[model samples]
Target: MSDSIFSIPIIAGTFLLAGVVKGVIGLGLPTVAMGLLGLVMPPVQAAALLLVPSLVTNLWQLLAGPRFGALLRRLRGMMLGIALGTVAGSGLIAGPATGAATTALGLALAAYAVVGLFGPALRVPPRAEPWAGPVLGAVTGVVTGATGVFVIPAVPYLAALGLARDDLVQALGLSFTVSTLALAAGLFWHDALPLQAAGASLLALVPALAGMALGGWLRARVRPGTFRLCFFLGLLALGGELAWRGLG
Candidate 1:
């Protein structure tokens, strides 16, 4: 799938649609893009192609908030843990065993959908966050290395931090940036990412950003919770399919 000329349209369409979802919901660009792209491409290659758009968009999110210094100071531990854990698990993806990585991606997607929709509303006190942040970030980093999906515990962890609405959004950006870069490092360590994939990843930014604009327009005119429900359902179904394919 990576070598085919047809992959270009697939990549663009996937990112554009995924960007739309992210613009509307304020998250899920990589999740949705990987889920869809996984159908036609290897998870490793798909993840590689995600680098440019994902990093660019996430950096935008990271710097968009007001409390970046405060957030960075607070999340530095988690960021470091993520980097370490990704390096630790760099061998999990790409290779003859990548089917396992695909299956992990599927499970991660399903888990994220479930958690996003009905997960517990646990709260973390300041003391707990100091320890919990690094632990959860490491766990998420392992998952990201294996599957390139990093939202599971990270999102829930941030949600529990008692941050304001906008702060939470910015926090997601920062966490995503770290995760994306960590995955990039992991792919590079495994020698799984190639120059062509990087070029494709760079090209993906145009459609992704365009789709985000469209989604933002829809966001203002439509209800967010309603869109979110459908989004989770889609993730559930896609995750199941990917898992089944991986296991088969």
Candidate 2:
């Protein structure tokens, strides 16, 4: 949506809400904002609007944790895969094939929701890391490049690493930060992200941060598992709608 007095408030409110969700659960800002905003605007525009806030917040989340070096060392392969895969898939945003892209994005989201809700959590043995890391990361990157959402095999893969809770949060942050940067580069190459939209995306960060602060305070008191359930359910519904939009 174009910047206007009315649209600006809506944009801010969407980011505020998405930020609160991210603050509580350590993810979902882009998923929530892009999914909801897509109803009124182009999904690519929604994805573009998410760029600055996504980068700033995710970087903040990554740096706030203690395992930056170790996580980097551990996930190096995956990170490399994400960067390359995102670039490879960048043409989807620039091409005229958006209908197919959105369909794939919807299916991916629905699959992610199913995995989160009912699937067993699997553990990856240390020995498998060499091969598994790049594969999962590349898949996650492809999904992010196509859909503007980054959680998929990546989240489950990271969780499988059996990190401590804080480490998992930081890992998500690290992955998301990489995904955000990669997505930005992809969009720029595709010419989908204009300079004016970038400026507005930067401005959207204020409300996002504010909502994050509020959510962080509430996180101490809320049951995250409950919120997680709601989050997935919401995603499932949104995914269904998006899929329908694409198929219809």
Candidate 3:
């Protein structure tokens, strides 16, 4: 991998910021990292370069030791949906189709954020069965595979669950870890995982880990509503960037 003087510093800062956000909010690293990295590299390369750091950070999130079994039982159906959607989306990562799909995904996320900012209170009561997971998962997975934009419908569902802060963070971390791994595997199978890109991604772990540590500390003191608003706004900015890149 050829080293650019700017790449490492840029990626380091991006990962640091992403890690902090993810640490505080349970999700947003990938969205924030890729969005910022895309500014420095091609979108595809930026997405590929995030694989290792994202996976590593997620591993940390999982290790923070939340109730995985309980989380799975509560969201199994949605998980399955995510899996199916990711697989399907992975299959579509070819040529212009991928670009168009990613652009749409970006727009959708931006729209979702806007709604959250102004929309009425969203409530999806705990049900014996909630079918939204499958639907949302499919969409999220497809977008993840196609563009690495994987934070759309999934966030809303988790938000609606009204989980305790820790549980919510853990759930998001686990889901992202699984989904990112699946996406990476698909890319590898297709020979889309370039060595240079992978190497850069691995290097990003340094900043990501540091940021997570800092963010975790902050999470202990930050107000939930304030943190959530920041998270949503972050999404809005990143999502808008993606939309512009894809559409422009």
User: lDDT tens string, model 2, 46-107?
Assistant: 78899999999999999999989999999999999888888777677556776776776677
lDDT of the structure predicted as candidate 2: 0.86
Q: Which regions of candidate 2 deviate over 4 angstroms?
A: 1-6
Strongest candidate by TM-score: 1
Error of 3 at 37 (Å): 1.1
* Per-residue lDDT over 1-248 for candidate 1, one digit per residue giving the tens place of the 0 to 100 score: 35678878888999999999989999999999999988887788889989889999999988989999999999999988888887677678766686897899899999999987898898999988788989999998888888888787899999999999999999999999988988898889889988888888999999999989999999999899999999999999999999999998
Candidate 1 whole-model C-alpha lDDT, 0 to 1: 0.89
Considering only N, C-alpha and C atoms within 3 Å, which residue pairs clash in candidate 2?
none
Q: What is the C-alpha lDDT of each candidate?
A: 0.89, 0.86, 0.75
Q: What is the full ranking by lDDT, best candidate first? A: 1, 2, 3
Question: What is the TM-score of candidate 2?
Answer: 0.95
Which candidate number has the best lDDT? 1
Model 2 residue 208 CA deviation in Å: 0.9
What is the C-alpha lDDT profile of model 3 across 72-109, one tens digit per residue? 88888777777777766665553446466557656756
Better of 2 and 3 by TM-score: 2
